[model samples]
Target: MSRIAESFKNGKAFIGFVTGGDPSLEKSEEFILEMVRGGADLVEIGIPFSDPIAEGVVIQEANIRALSAGATVDKIFDLVASLRKRTEVPLVFLTYLNPVFNYGFSRFFQRCADLGVDGIIIPDLPYEEKGELAEIAAGFGVDVISLIAPTSEQRIKQIAQEATGFIYVVSSMGVTGMRSEIQTDLKAILEVVKGVSSIPTAVGFGINTPKQAGEIAKITDGVIVGSAIVKIIEKHGENAGPYIYDYVQSMKNAVKELD
Candidate 1:
């Protein structure tokens, strides 16, 4: 079974985040290992871009640092190729359209498939842009996941239709960041996506605490914690792994309540 589908069948939501090239390639790999050990059912390795418009301050800075360190598309594949040896959890690439275009969509997907990546989350490439890439992805058995905002039911359903892996449901109206509380009618949003798509749905944006993760897990197939995990890495640098472990464990413990 696909790692993502297998996790949902086990009656647990998944936790995914984007950590492309952090302080260094070595540290980035360490961070991923920590996230896995911390109860992440899937990991989104973002290939650092020159301009990450969808990201907030925390991740923007990380991208800059990674770019400065020369984290390229080739480097990211190499990192994933190496990581494939140790980790078996689903690995999804979160990237922008420009990089994919630059790398040649066919070549990019082929390399990722060769390296054992299970899925991809390209924020800028909306459902309208899913012609060639989607075909390329499907041929390799890689799911091309899509995202939706809280405001657009029409757009949400359209995005969900194209979503091969889990549909990423943005919990808020703004760009990605950590927030104190989730939107009030999150359950309704999840239901909206659920009503349209047979695939699993995972919510992200502004999800910070274990309490929030628990609450979100109650509604969707999974909760994605990005800014919170980024904050841990920002605060502790190399010691970020332990923080990731603790925080992920808290969310996992919370999910256990539902099971």
Candidate 2:
């Protein structure tokens, strides 16, 4: 099985995301290791972009902080290279298309292959336009993960059928952030995806607390927490490692309970 597929094979996956170089690249690596130590099955590292259209206030601020701290594409690649030496956990890039375009798709995916990145999530890349990078990414064995929002009514089937890695089921309609409640009829969406494809589905966007994680895990194969983790880092800055480990451990335990 692909590394991404293997992540969901044992049980419900707890996928964690953090903005790369948020506090600093070193801290980014530290936080990721902590997440793995805390039982995260997969990790999504955001390559800071100037205009992250899919991000909310928390992550947008994180992007700015990372950029200001000099988080370049090269630097992020180096970060992944260093991470590969320490862990084999699946590492996926959550980035916009512009940077990949600027970096050259072939060169970018080649680096990903070389550095042990298993998959990528491009929020801005539409399903139809995925061909722009999908073909190249596939050549290098990188899965271009697909996202399905509640608004993806008829297209959900189409997207799921073609999806390579696990499908990212967006819990709400808006951008990424924490929310008190996610009333998007997610089970209905998962039903559609399951009908067409056996690929694992993970719900993300606005998922924070263990209660929410457990509730969502009951319905989906996994739960993805981003803004919540980023919030922890934002509050703790360079010292967010142990806090991240604790939070992720709690979240993972919540998901594992469903198993």
Candidate 3:
């Protein structure tokens, strides 16, 4: 099984996300390791972009912080290279398409393959346009994960059928951030995906708290927590490691209870 697929086999996966070079690349590495230590089955490293259209204020500010701190595509690649020496936990990139195109798809995916990145999640890349990188990425054994939003009613089946790795089910209609409640009919959307594909599905966007995680885990194969963790890092800055570890441990335990 692919590393991404293997992550879901153990039970409901708890996927954690943090911006690469937020505060600093060293700190980013530290936080990622802490997430793994706390029980993240998979991790997504955001390659900071100037205009992260899919991000809310929390992550948008994180992008700015990372960029101001001199986060570069090459630097992020080096960060992943360093991370591979320490852990084998699945690492995925949550990035926009411009950076990948600017870095050159073949070179980018080659680096990912060499550095042990399991998959990638591109928010703005439409399912129809995924061919722009999907073929190249697959050549290097990298799965181009597909995102199915609440608005993607008819397209959910089509996206699921072609998706590699796992499908990211957006829990609401808006961008990424924590919400008081996810009002989408996620169970129905997941039902469509399951009908067409057996690939694991993880619900993200606005998911925070163990109660929310456990509730979502009962319906999906996994739960992805990004903004909530980013908020923790934002509040603590360089000293966010222990806080991250504790928070992730609680979130992971929440998901683990389903097993």
Instruction: In angstroms, give how far residue 164 of model 3 lies from its true place.
Output: 0.7
lDDT of 3 by residue, 147-181 (tens): 99988978888999999899999999878999999
The per-prediction tally of clashing pairs is 0, 0, 0
Error of 3 at 56 (Å): 0.3
lDDT of 2 by residue, 166-217 (tens): 9999999889999999999999999999999999999999999999999999
What TM-score does each of the candidates earn? Answer: 0.95, 0.99, 0.99
- Give RMSD to native, each candidate: 1.4, 0.6, 0.6
Error of 2 at 78 (Å): 0.7
Error of 2 at 184 (Å): 0.3
- Local error of candidate 1 at residue 189 (angstroms): 2.3
The C-alpha lDDT values of all candidates are: 0.82, 0.96, 0.96
Off by over 4 Å in 3: none
